[model samples]
Target: MKRILLINPWIEDVSAYDYWLKPLGLLYISSALKTLGVEPVLVDCLDRYDSDLLSYSSGSGEKYFGTGKFVETVVPKPDCIASIPRRFKRFGFPEEVFRSKLQQLDHVDGVFVTSMMTYWHYGVSDTIRVVRQELPSIPIVLGGVYATLLPEHAKRNAGADLVCPGTGMKPIEKALLFLGINKSVQPDWFDELSPDYSAYESPHYAVVITSLGCPFRCVYCASSYLWRHFLRRDPTKTAEHIEYLVKSSNLSDIVFFDDAILVGGGFKTLMKEIEHRSIRTRFHLPNGVHARFVDRETADLMYANNFKTIKIGLETSDRALQTSTGGKVFLNDIYRAVDNLSKAGFTYKEISAYIMLNLPGQSEEDVLDSLRICEELGLSPTLNEFTPIPGTLQWKELIERGSFAEDIDPLLLDNSIIPHWWKQGFSLDTVQRLKEAAWSLRRKLSGE
Candidate 1:
């Protein structure tokens, strides 16, 4: 049997949190290679339970349903963002620890590296470098969002033997074939194979990708650029996975990582199956759901099925901006969704509206108005800062206006630096005041 190694690269960013985050794509690939009779060794740099890492942990302690911060080491800022006033850090295992882990592997035929945010490519590049230093002759393949969105940049910067773009398990199979190990079996959909979460230490919560690719292409989003087409997994199969998880362990929560979970009627069917199975796991839709899809039936089903957290994408209240920015949602859609959710016995505090800020031409008042609309509708507000992604419409506009450099380092793309670093149309004071107002409203609603 061919031996294959898979790695989850560390994240080099100002800050990062583990909100039930897991590399589902990489796990799925692991499942595929194992089924093809390849011996797979999985190494996650961000593994929280690593005995060596835990010894060095600062005793931050996990909080709130197994979701908390990742222990990070402060590193020097990259030259491109040297002027920015925030400390850069690597949010995973230390260099020596990672190298020691690599040294333990033997005669690996191929290595697969996974990436996350575009700005966090520094981690991916560093991981590839260390892998090359440790295993010089093995072929390395890089894949994930950063590779898919900015393939040319990754090719030029990320020192990998090959870079595979987009979704699916074909890249892993292809890499195995390169090593002269071929599986002459009938092809099946990538989503059909269950992700191998058993590879990790027991996890308290799991992430489920019931669907992929959103139909609406928001100007600031890279969903369309990354996924080939919209796809949804079989509802019964998804329920079976959830049931297996609950039965195998004390799994109490699940976070839906779908870009759009309710695009089709699949959510309703999945809920029905879960209800039939009597599985009592709490569900969270951290990725914003489409407001237009929330009807009386779906809303009630979600409430009945124990969806504790629901966040809706209400980008802006400006009608023209709404129409221009992909027309995904509007003021009326927000009102209707909120009404339906309230009727389903969900409290206002349970449902939050994501109001986007810091667009190229977006003003402070525009964002403030959206917050006001959400407040009027008795919904809590979450301020989502706009980060210019490589292939998006807003990215091109920022580049044309000379506000962003043609060869800008991806580190500057962090969303938290919006008001602090970039002054597109709003001043620092305006941004500060608007943020304060939003938080103030949230506190008042929660009676904190």
Candidate 2:
């Protein structure tokens, strides 16, 4: 059988955390490759539970609910952001460990590497460099969010033999074809396949996507752009998959990574199925859900199904800004949703609201007002620092209006680094103040 090596690269950034971070796309691709009669060898750099990693670190870094910090090593800053006064670090397995893993692997036909954030392209490039050094003759392929959003940049910089830049099985098929494998991937692979978690041993949590793509076209979001249409799996089948994970893997926590999980009524049905099966495990919705969909029934279902983390997307409380940016939620919708969640027995600690900072045309007062609303509703506030996505409407508007050069380094667009260079948005001092305010509110809500 043909063997293919799959790699989840290290995240090179100023800071990184493992909030149940699973390479869902890579795992799905692994499953697809398996269905095509290929063997997949996984080298998940972020797998904290790997025995080799545990031996290297001398212990695990796990904190509460399978969410914690990644093992980090300080590295030299890239010339583009070298002047930024923060330490640039690579967060994942040590370099020697990665090299050791690669050396131990048996003969493989090709190597596939997956990437995440666009700003993390440096990580992708570095990963591909190491792969090339270790296996000089093997073909390397790169695909993921970064590759899809910045195909040209990835092609120029990522150093992949072939850069497949699309979603679903199309990219996988392309990679397979590039390797002379004549397998046609099914279009309905999203519904037919589950992320291959078998590669992980003793994982604290698992992430499942009930649906792909978002129906709402928020200017700042890339979900609608990445996925052309919203596709949902059979709720019953999804629940069965969850049950299998719970029973087979002994997983206690399951996270929903859907961009718009609650857009349709499917989430409610899925929750009902989980309840019917009496699958006793914690559920988390770290991705913000639409406030308009959090009706009493939905909130009740979430609470009944043991949802431990519930975050509502209340990007901004400004009425005009709300309408201007997708109009997905308004003040009253937030109020009603919070009321329903509260009535359903969710406490302030279990619920939170996402408030965006540094958005174009947004003032400091707008963000402060949104935080005040979260305070009034007794929900913790999660201040999301804005990062300009390349293909979004906001990105095009920024480029057209000369906010920054179109060929600007993607690293400068990172939320942590944007304030230092981008003058159009809030300055570094102002962003610091806003973060402090949000942190204070979270501390208050947590009774700290």
Candidate 3:
């Protein structure tokens, strides 16, 4: 029997919070391996329920709506940013715990490691180093956003035998063959395999994606580079999987990780199925939704189907900026969507508007205008600092215009750095003022 091990690497950053973080791509690979009759074991570093790690934390790991914090440990700063004057930490199990977990798995034929956010490659590098020391001969394969975007950099620095990119499973299949395991698992994307989260121990929430990729090519987003094309699963089958998870696992919270959920009536059809089956669960879209798609009918369906959390992308009120950055939503579109959702009984607190800040040429006035607009519409404003992603339009333009260094390390792409690291003309003080304005609006709206 071929037994493979999968590891979700720790997140190394100045600050981190668990906003329903799960290695969905790695879980899909596990599910596909299972379908091919291969045994798979998982070591999720960010498992909040792990009693050993929870024992070290100051607070119990209870979560609200399946969103919470990860138990973290302070770690040394990378030499590149040592003078940044912030406490760098690893947001997950301690190193000893990870090593102990790896030691427990016997006869591991091969290993698969996954990464997120390209800038967190330090965590990926550290995880691979530990794996090599423990299982010297076992071949390790790396995959995920970081691997896909910066394949050569990850291959050179991540210390993995092979780096697999994109959604296809061909590279992994080939890696297994190289390891003397002769079996072929059809790619899960074609079959639309439901990720088997049963491997998790008492998970509070499960993430499901009815669709993959977005049609709109946002300048700052890398969805097109990672996915290449938009593909959606059968809505009926998606509803069935959701029903199974809710009933069997006694779970109430399900998050949609789709880059864009409403490609072609996908959201409406899935909601209708859930309503017909009477599957009552709180749906969440931490990934922003397209404001233009939310009409009167869609809003009512979302409310009827119990969408507890809804975030619409209104990146900027500047019409030119909006047009250049995919133009998926207009000012009128947001206004109408909020109106429809409000009429359908969703309160202002339930609807959140995502306003992007700290883009290449974004000004303080632009950001402040967006916040004021959201406040006027009675929607909670959430500020998202822009990160320059590789292979995106913004990245290419930044490099061409001499705004960003061409040879910049991916680690510097942290969103937290904001205007200080990647702005065109904004000062740190201006960025601070913008954050303060956003916070004040949020507090006033919440009546805090």
lDDT string, candidate 2, 122-230, tens digits = 9899988999999999999999999999999999999999999988888888899999998987778877899999988778799999999988999999999999998
User: Residue-wise lDDT of candidate 3 within 240-264, one digit each (tens)?
Assistant: 9999999988886999988889667
Q: What is candidate 2's local distance difference test score?
A: 0.91
Each candidate's lDDT (Cα)? 0.82, 0.91, 0.84
Q: Which model is ahead, 2 or 3, in terms of lDDT?
A: 2
- The RMSD (Cα, Å) of candidate 3 is 1.6
Which portions of model 1 miss their true places by more than 4 Å?
58-60, 183-187, 418-423
By TM-score rank, best first, the candidates go: 2, 3, 1
Order the candidates by lDDT, highest first.
2, 3, 1
What is the per-residue lDDT of model 1 for residues 227-337, given as tens digits with 9 covering 90 to 100? 768888898999999899878867878888899998977999999998999988888898889999999899999988898889999878888888898999877778899
CA shift at 316, candidate 1, in angstroms?
A: 0.6
TM-score of 3: 0.96
62, model 3: CA deviation in Å? 3.4
TM-score against truth, every candidate: 0.94, 0.98, 0.96
Question: Model 2: residues >4 Å from true position, as ranges?
Answer: none
